[model samples]
Target: MPVPIPGNPLGYTLVYAIDSPKGPVLVDAGWNHPDAWAALRGGLLSLGIEVGSVSGVVVTHFHPDHAGLAGQVREASGAWIAMHEADAALVKLMRGFAEEEHHDFQADMLRRAGAPAEEVGAAAGQRPWVPAQPDRELRDGDLVDVPGRTLRAIHTPGHTPGHLCLHLADADRLFTGDHVLPGITPHVGIYPYDRDDVDPLGDFLTSLERVADLGGDRLLTALPAHEWIFPDVAARAAEIRHHHEEKLSTLAGLLADRAEPPTIWETAAMMTWNKPWEDLPPMLRGMAAGEAAAHLRALEARGHIRRVQGVDPVRFQALDS
Candidate 1:
């Protein structure tokens, strides 16, 4: 069922309802607005499932667009919610990140990325990193108790540390949340922490391969959160992986050709974007910098680049150059 996301161009999120012996199980709940709530209720009512008939909820990740109304649903239905433990912790961290220290941390992060004063201010308020408490914290390969369905949680941690994709091998389908989308490549970045420490891009690439391997014979259908259903889960994963690979190569080329070494912020500006670098909003630009830092760290790990640390904003160059 497509539940509307008020004020979003993406229109709505697909909240799949699976028939179980107990009651209906919803894969996701759209935005937690009155309009979105009505949409979900109406959809469920039409399906002969009451708003309170939902027995359980499985969030693919902790993003608000996907899990926004989850709390509301459980409140109404007494439904148990489950998510990977890493994401549960991330949600807590995100919700607590609205304090003065967190704001200062973000500003410092942007400064380290070489962002200007105005951009730093615009990017500082990344509030509402929200989630509800999960009744059960899942691990990789754990079998979810979605009555009558053999749904196994596959920890695909790149999109958001504890992001999960449910593999229903019995039905030959995969419920890929934001981990794998048909029309968009998931964003992976290092931020609010040491870029030298986290390698989100690397983790994302590896997770893609793992999910692709799960596809086995490529006969499975992919049911992504945002987009419509599609077939050939393996091919789609390969396409997304290659998309990131191309980005890695492009960044390596930029590092190789520069007259002077580039800071994370400078390299992000130099890299390609669907929109011109300067034209992107301040928040998105900050996100771009974080992503660039992730790629640089990944390349450093791969021995394709070397870090020139101790610079205010960290700098790097091609190792072979």
Candidate 2:
């Protein structure tokens, strides 16, 4: 089912409905906008299901676009919502934090990522959100209650700390929730909203290996959160893994420059972007920096680069430097 997100790059998110003994179990709830909500309801109705009849919801993560309607659905259908514990903790933290405090936290993060003062001041107001908390906490290897279907949760912690990919044993299908998408690589950047992330890119690479292993020869098609579905998830996994490996190598070369060891900002600017880095909007630029930082952290963790302190903006260099 297609549920639209306002001003989203992708036109809409695909919400998969599984027919179960109790009722239809939904994969993810769409955006919170009125039109988006309407689209979701209409889509469900078209499938001969009512909004109030959804039995369960397995949220892949706590991203606003994915979990926006979760609360509304639960209220309407009394459907039990389940998500990864890590993302659930984040949602709860957001719920507890005051608006001003949350804004300040986001502004501080922008500043840390080398955002200019003006953008930092306007960061929180750009798009504010508070996703509903999950009623159930999912962990790796946990099976979602799909009655006859054996849907196991794979905790993939790169897209988000609690990102999940649901494996359908009976159908040999993998419902990859922004963990793997067709044609493009999923962002493994740090969420600058709050808290420090450690080795996110590393975690992402590991998760790719795990998914590839699971899908080895028996895998069927991959149903991603966006775009079209495709076969050969393992081949796609290898492509993504190689992309990161090449990025690491490229960053290492840049860091190894004798005269100009780069800061995270410099590295991001110098790295090839889908579009010119300078042309991207402030928020996207900050996201780019966070992605660069994730790579830097991954390199540091694996002893490929050394971080230099005492500098105003901080800098990194090849470990041999």
- Which candidate wins on lDDT? 2
TM-scores for the candidates: 0.93, 0.94
Q: Over 4 Å off in model 2, which ranges?
A: 99-103, 124-128, 192-197, 258-261
Against the reference, the lDDT scores of all candidates come to 0.84, 0.85
lDDT of 1 by residue, 1-321 (tens): 888888776788999888888888889888889999999999999889997989989999888788899999999999999999998887777667654455566777888777777877765655555668788899999998877789999999877889999998789999998888888887787875346767778898999989888966657789998878988878888999998889899989889998778888888899888799989877678778877888888888888998776777677989766
Tell me which residue pairs clash in candidate 2: none
Model 2 over residues 49-124: C-alpha lDDT tens digits? Answer: 9999999999999987799898999999999999999989988877765555435666767766556678778866
Q: What is the model-wide C-alpha lDDT for candidate 1?
A: 0.84
Evaluated at residue 246, the lDDT of candidate 2 is 99
